[model samples]
Target: MRRGASASHLDAAAAVDAALPAWLGLPNNAEKVLLTLRAARVAATARGVAATALGVAATAPVVAATALATTMAELLQRLFELQEGHKELLQRHEELRQRRM
Candidate 1:
């Protein structure tokens, strides 16, 4: 009877140990499950990174076009400002000539 009770106690203790979370300490079965979960998480992260890289690759052309358009707009604005300044300078020169005459 005493030997049977000790065996039963050990079985109960083992059951409790197995039921405990992996973070405390894991038996073989729990360790396997934890490893699988970690692998799955890593795979998910890798897939997300791959998707992001593809998205950036797809948008590269659009981004370059937008940058080009912005540069052209800035250049046009500078040209207009320079033209306006030239017109003002010509008008001032004409006024000075009329005064001299």
Candidate 2:
């Protein structure tokens, strides 16, 4: 089951990499980096959603709910950072491509 999930994730990453403009000229390793970043962002988003759901469903105490919200917010921040990093990597890839031309 775990292996299947990993394979699914890899397939998703490959699809995302393939959809990007080839003119960007990112290498395979760079593509992998993008994939990892994207996965991290997704995980963070899932965590945030789960946390929110749990808080709501459990009727957590105000303090506990606040903490969960804060954690979820931090996860969101991490996701944004991962996205930014991915963008930077793509930008760098493009710059390198232009330089090679």
Candidate 3:
């Protein structure tokens, strides 16, 4: 949270602010959106894993298993995406919050 942003820009800032749930290191305002997404996806995976173990139908077990496998694959893909986004955002945040040093 710096200064001079209008309501709309402030809203955008706030949105990003909401995304970032934690702040470990920064000179200025940073770290939000990506962290929230990460936490959500991890929670989703755990839920999905549990759901997969539950009995659903007799004839549809194969279909269900396939869907569960596909979901797990997509979940993994999204996790990788978050890792890359985190790396990129960390660099950008550092650049934005620079100081004379």
What's the TM-score of each model vs. the native?
0.36, 0.42, 0.37
**Count of clashing residue pairs in every prediction:** 0, 0, 4
lDDT of 3 by residue, 1-101 (tens): 44655767979877775543354354332343455565677766655564557653333435444565677668777877776687688778778778533
Candidate 3 C-alpha error for residue 42, in Å:
4.9
The number of clashing residue pairs in model 2 is 0
Query: Model 2, range 1-101, lDDT digits (tens) per residue?
Result: 69999999999888866675454776646655665677677766666576566654333444344565677668767867776687788789889999999
Give the root-mean-square deviation of each candidate in angstroms. 31.7, 7.7, 9.4
Once model 3 is optimally superposed onto the true structure by TM-score, how far is the C-alpha of residue 57 displaced, in angstroms?
19
How does residue 52 of candidate 3 score in lDDT? 55
Q: Tell me the lDDT of candidate 2.
A: 0.68
Off by over 4 Å in 3: 1-65, 99-101
C-alpha lDDT (0 to 100) for residue 11 of candidate 2: 100
- Higher-lDDT candidate of 1 and 3: 3
The global C-alpha lDDT for each of the candidates, from Candidate 1 onward, is 0.58, 0.68, 0.61
Error of 3 at 13 (Å): 26
